[model samples]
Structures are given as C-alpha cells and as structure tokens.
Target: MARCETCGNDYDRTFEVHMEGKTHTFDSFECAIYELAPRCAHCSVPIVGHGVQKDDVLFCCNHCATAVGVHELRDRA
Candidate 1:
C-alpha cells in the first residue's frame, strides 16, 4: 500500500489512481500534479523552480523556492 507523502493518508479505493513502479496507489491525480507542478517564487502558484547556487547549496526553484529563501531553513540544522 502506497501512502501520500504530504497527507500521510493510505491510498484506498476512495482516492484517484496512479501507477508508480508497477504498483497502483490512490492519491487523486490532482495531488500528484501538484507535486510535479511548478510554483511562483513569491506565491505558491504553479510556476517553475530555478535560482542561483551559493557555496554548495542548491536552490530548487528560482521563483518560489528562492523567493522564500528556504536555504535559511536548511542552514538552521
């Protein structure tokens, strides 16, 4: 049984269907699309991931990921 990485819900017959590695799971195709979808740098709309790399850090997205400066979060650890 595959589980949703976000909601941590069991993919049962009540959800949408998708194939991953020969196994089938339920998670609403919309959710899957959202994961793959791009987002705005400032907002959270579907956009794209791009940015500059400093030191050895990587900015997943230029717009959304970089805008939020998630690198700070990564450095807190």
Candidate 2:
C-alpha cells in the first residue's frame, strides 16, 4: 500500500502524473487534483514539487497551505 505524503491516507494504486516534464506519483485521484490545482498562497498558478502539511493543517503546497492556514475542520473519531 502507498500512503499519501500530504494527507497520510493509504491507497491501493499509485498514479503517475506529468508536471513540468517530470513524473510524480499520487495516492489517489483527489490527491492528484489537489497537487495540480492552480491556487496557491503566493500566486494563482499551479503548484509543483512536494505537498505541504503542518500540524493539523494541509495545503496544496507549503505556500498556500501556510497562507490559507488550515484548521481541524473534521474529526474522524
């Protein structure tokens, strides 16, 4: 099983996506989209490189995640 680096979710399949002429693997469809979406803290352009996670906060990237400031919006337990 592969675990999402950002959300820490386990998944069965790993998707290979091309970005900036480089290929990256994601754990799920939603995770791939989150990485590709063009909404960041610094700009509206799509984010590249590794996803960002801080404490209980999650961001598409470090900049946006830091900018938007994520909170514990859900409780699994």
Candidate 3:
C-alpha cells in the first residue's frame, strides 16, 4: 500500500510518477493530475496542454494570460 502525499490517504493500488527528480504516488488519476499537473497561476486550474508561462507564473490559455495582464509568449521555431 502507498500513501498519497496530498490527501494523506492510503491506497492498495497506487500509481507512481517521477518528476523533477522526485517520486510521487497517487491512488487515482484525478489525484495524480491534481498533485502533478501544472496549474494556471491566475485561475488555479490544471493545465493539460502546453501552458503559457510568463515570468514565473503559468496560464492555461491566452485568455487567462490576458485576464491576468501577463504577456504571453509566442510560438517557437
């Protein structure tokens, strides 16, 4: 059994994920996404795709970036 770091719940069949040279365990996909997913800095929602990053904050989309007054980065080559 593994314990979830976020919810402090123990699970019989938990999934493990490695990120940033660290290991994280979760009981469900939702938990894993909640714990590991990149979140929007302004809305605080989980960012599924390539999120916009301005300065040190992350945004889910251009609307969110515009709403927060952060200049969104352009596409790469």
Candidate 4:
C-alpha cells in the first residue's frame, strides 16, 4: 500500500508518476494530473498536451498566447 502525497490518502491501488527525478504517488488520476500538471500563464488552465510556448512562458493555446501579447511569432504567420 502507498500513500497519495497530494490528497494524503492511504491507497492500496495508487499510481506513481516520475518527473524531474522525483516520484509522486496519487490515489486517483484527478489528483495526479491536478497536482503535477503545468498550467497556462494566461488562463491558468492545466496544460495536458504539448502547450504553446513563447520564450519562457507557456500558454494553453495560440489564442491565449496572442491574448497575452506573447505570441509575436505566431501573429506574423
């Protein structure tokens, strides 16, 4: 049995996620992705897929990037 680090639940069927050399256990997929997922800079939404990047900032989509005035490269296209 493993303890979920995020929700502090003692789970017998928890899942593990390894990221940046750190291991985390979660009792459910919601806690796993919610606690470990990256969020968009503009809208604060969880970026599940490969998000749009500009410089060092991350956006959930091109519209968010453009809305934040960071997608200059995309605006030219």
Candidate 5:
C-alpha cells in the first residue's frame, strides 16, 4: 500500500501520477487534481481542462484572461 501525498492516507489501491519529473501517489482522482492541477492566474481556481495560457500566466477561461487585460483571448472558435 502507498500513502497518498495530498491527504496523507495510507491506502491499498493508490495510484501514481508523473508530471514535470515528479511522481505523486493519490488514493483518488480528487486528491491528484488537488495537488497537481495548475491554478488560474486571475481566479486562483485549479484548471482541470484545456485552460488558456499567455506567456507565463495561466487562466481558467478566456473571460478570466480578458478580465485581467488580456484582450486577444477567446472562449471558443
């Protein structure tokens, strides 16, 4: 059994996620997301999908990017 890195739970069915040259063990997907997902620059929410990015900044959506004076982003095509 491996211990979850996020919740510190020792479980039997834990899984490992490799990202950016690091390995993380989690008991559930929720824990993995909480620990590994990138946060939006404007709202500070974890971006779980194909989020918007401009240079070194990240945003959950185009609206948030635009709200922060990033005018060229769009929500969709």
Candidate 6:
C-alpha cells in the first residue's frame, strides 16, 4: 500500500504521476488533478485541457487570457 500525497490516504490502488522529474502519488484521479493541474491566471480554475498561454502565464480559455490583457488569443477561427 502507498500513501496519497494530497489527502494523506493510504490505499493499495494508489498510483503515481510523474511531472517535471518529480513523482506524485494519489489515491484517486481527483486528488491528482487537484494537486498537479495548472491554475488559470485570471479565474484561478484548474486547467484540465489544452489551455491558452500568453508569455509565461497560463489561462484556461481565451476569455480569461483577454481578461488579463492578452488580446491576441482567440477561441475559434
């Protein structure tokens, strides 16, 4: 059994996620996402998909990017 890093749960089915040369153990996907997902620069929501990036900042959508003064990003063609 392994211990979850997020909620401190110990379970036999715990899994490991590797990111940026680091390893994270979690009992469920929810905890993993909560710990690993990048937050939007504007609304502070977890980015689960291919989010927009302006310079070094990450935004969950074009609207969020625009809210933070990133006007060149578009959600659709």
Q: Residues 1-77, candidate 4: write the lDDT tens digits.
A: 99998889998999889999999899998998789889999899988888888878888888899887864645234
lDDT preference between candidates 4 and 5, better one:
5
Tell me, by TM-score, which candidate is best.
5
Ranked candidates, highest lDDT first: 5, 6, 4, 3, 2, 1
TM-score of 1: 0.35
Local lDDT at 10 for model 6: 89
Q: Clashing pairs in model 2?
A: 41-64
RMSD of each: 9.6, 12.2, 2.9, 2.6, 1.0, 1.0
Badly placed stretches (over 4 Å) of model 3 are: 71-77
Pairs of residues clashing in candidate 3: none
**Tens digit of per-residue lDDT, candidate 3, span 2-73:** 898878789898888999999998888888888889999889999878978887888888778878776546
- Which structure is stronger by TM-score: 1 or 2? 2
- lDDT of model number 1: 0.49
Q: Native-vs-model 6 lDDT?
A: 0.93
lDDT for model 4 comes to 0.86
Query: What is the TM-score ranking, best to worst?
Result: 5, 6, 4, 3, 2, 1
Candidate 5 off by > 4 Å: none
**For residues 1-77, could you state the per-residue lDDT of candidate 5 as single tens digits?**
99999999999999999999988899999999889999999999999999999999999999999999998877788
Task: List, residue by residue over 10-73, the lDDT tens digit for candidate 6.
Answer: 8999999999999999999999989999999999999999999988899999999988789999
Which tens-of-lDDT digit does each residue in 1-77 have in candidate 2? 77675477777876678889977678877777677665444455544544455554344554455456554322222
What lDDT, from 0 to 1, does candidate 2 have? 0.59
lDDT accuracy of residue 18 in candidate 3: 95
lDDT of 4 at 23: 90
